[model samples]
Every structure is written in C-alpha cells, then in structure tokens.
Target: MIDKVFPTPDEALHDVFDGATIMFGGFVTAGTPTNLILALQRRGTKGITGIANNIGLGDKLDVLCEQRQLAKMIATFAIRASGARQSLFEEQYRRGEVELELVPQGTFVERIRAAGAGIGGFLTRTGLGTLVQEGKQIVNVDGVDYLLEKPLRADFALIKAFKADRLGNLVYRGAGRNFNPAMATAADVVIAEVEHLVETGELDPETIGTPGVYVDRVVQCEPVPVRWYG
Candidate 1:
C-alpha cells in the first residue's frame, strides 16, 4: 500500500535543509500554503532561495523575509507598485541584504513548466531589447532576437489545495489553484497543504489538478482567513 499523508507540516518538511531552493505556490494570498510556510518558519532554516509569483503582497512569506531566512528570491513581483505597502522582502532588497531575480510572470511559469517537462531552456521574445535580456544569451532566428530562458527547479515545493487524498492526489478551489499544480510538478520533494484530507479515491479523477505521483506528502490544515498585511 502507498500512503503519502503526513501528520503535520513540520514532519512533511523535515528533510528541507539550509541553503535549499524552494518553490512556493500561490498568487498573492490565493492558494498560498500558509501552514507549510509557518512550519518552515518554525524550523528556522536559513539561506533559502525561494521562487514564487510574489514575495509578500499580504502572503505569510513575509515572515521569512523578516527573519532573514531567505538568501535570495526569484519572483515575478517582489515590490508593490505603490510605496505605501512595503513588504519586508522589499525592505531587505533595498538594504542589499537579500538578492532578487525579477522574472516576467509569463516567463516565470514557463520556466518552471520547462523544468518539469525536462527541457534544458527555451527561447522567447518576451525580454528582447530590454534589461531583462541583460546577462542572458540571445539568439537570432530569421532576423528576430529571442532571449534564452532557463528552466527553474527546486529542492522542495510547498503548495496548497482544496482537498487531497491519502495517496496525495490534489484538487484545488477557485483562484487557490494558481501555481499549485505547476509547482507540484517542478520540485524534487512536493508537500501539499490541503483544507481537507480524504480516503484514496475520494477525489474525482477529472477534478484532480496534481496527481499523487507528483506529490511526496500531504498535510491537512484548517482554512484560515487570508491575511493581506502583517
């Protein structure tokens, strides 16, 4: 018999070490794995390189920034458009305490998908003729320039889901599905924090966003109110 369910978030993340690259699945607070993030915060691992769509923006990930646990961030949005809502990540970035890699949102998701698909790299015109192309290889095809973007992979992926079975198949809800399925496929060890845990075969096959094969562990957590600011 195969079982991927874990009793707690901390146990599911026990193997995560210092200086590991991690993928965080979410768009702002939607689908964010707050329980797993909280567990990681409690574990106190440092020098993490986190890949996410946004660093803070009301997500619980800011606590990692406040704790100085992150060494670098590879994200699409790390700073707010207005200065009024400054995140700890932005403050650390401005102070030069942490490194930041600003990737275009489309490119970010594609890169992660490429990793799961086992592609070396891809060429795209998304960043051509801009600072985004700086330090990146550019290839010309038929007089058109395209920047080469490499795949993004991680040691661990922390994702959220609406429901998960003991076997680890995942079903997501609404905007909460954002990034969770893709991140589940792109990491070596994928841990899902779910609102409900059911027996195997409880989830409809058609509704499954992430297959059990891609998930290493599942942890059930209560639905918490989304916190937009710390």
Candidate 2:
C-alpha cells in the first residue's frame, strides 16, 4: 500500500530545514496553505527563501515575516500599491533586513513552470526595456531583444487543495487552484494541506489537478477563513 497521508501538517513538514527555498502556492489569500505555514512557523526555521505570488496581504505567511524567518523573498507582489497597509515583508524589505527579488507575474510563473518542465531558461520580451532585464542575459533574435529568465525551483512546495485522496491526488476549488499544480511539480518535496481527505478511488480522474506522483505528503486541515474577502 502506497500511502502519502500524514497525521498533521507539522509531521508532513518535519523535514523542512533552515535555509530552505520554499514555494508557497496562492494568489493573494486564495489557495494559501495556512496550516502548513503555521506549522513551519511553529518549527521556527529561519533563513528561508520564499517564492510566492504575494507576500502577506492577509495570507498567513505574514507570520513568518513577523518572525524574521525569511531571509529573502522571490515574489511578484511584495508591497501594497497604495502603501496604506504595510505588510511585515514590506517593512522588513524596506529596513534592509531581508532581500527581495521582484519578478514580473508572467515571468515568475513561467520560471517555475520551466523548472518543472526541465527547461534551463527562457527568453521573453516581457521586460526587454525595463529594470527586469538588468543583470540578466540579453539575447537578440531577428533584431529583437529578449531577457533570459532562469528556472525557479524550490526545496519544498506548500500547497492548499480542496480535497485529496489518500494517495495524494489533489483537487482544487475555483481560484484556490492558482499556483498549486505548477508548484507541485517544481519542488523536491510537495506537501498538500487539504480540506477533505478521501479514499484513493473517490476523486474523479478528470478533476485531479495534481497527481499523486508529484505529491510527497498530504495532510487534512480545516479551511482557513478568507478574512481578506470580508
């Protein structure tokens, strides 16, 4: 019997060490793996490099920022547009306590996807004439300039799912599916925090967003309230 289910988030993430690069699956607050983030917080591991679409912004990942556990962040959204609500990550970044790699949204996802697909890097014109092209290799093809973006991989990926089978086939709901599937494939270890855990055959094959092979562990957790939505 191949069972990937773990009793708790802590146990599922027991092997996560200090100075690990972790990919957090979410788009703002949606699909954020709150339980796993809490578990990692409890463990108090430091020097983490987190890759996410956004930092804090009502997501439980702010707790890590508050603890100064993150050494750096590679994300698309790390600060507020209006600068009204200052996130812990933004504060730390402004104070020079942590490093930030601000990547364009499309380029960010494509980098992670490239890692999963075994691609070395890609050339795109998305940021050809912007700061994003600085310090990056420039390639010219047909008299057009493109920036070379490297693949982004992580030591572990913490993802949230609507449901998962004991074997770890994941099914996501609505916006919750944002980065989970792609992150799952781009990490060395992938743990899923799901609302429901079902039997192996219960999940419909067509509905599975991340297959069991990509998932190393699965833990059931109660749905975290979406406070940002209120």
Task: After the best TM-score superposition of candidate 1, give how far the Cα of residue 215 lies from its true spot, in angstroms.
Answer: 0.4
- Model 2 segments more than 4 A misplaced: none
Lowest lDDT 10-residue stretch of candidate 1: 221-230
lDDT of 1 by residue, 1-230 (tens): 78999999999999999999999999988999998999999999999999999987867898997679999999999976676868788989989999999999989998999999899988899988788999999888899888999999999999999999999999999999888888998999999999999999778999998889999999999866776653
User: lDDT tens string, model 2, 192-215?
Assistant: 999999999999999999889999
Give the TM-score comparing model 1 with the true structure, all chains together: 0.96
Off by over 4 Å in 1: none
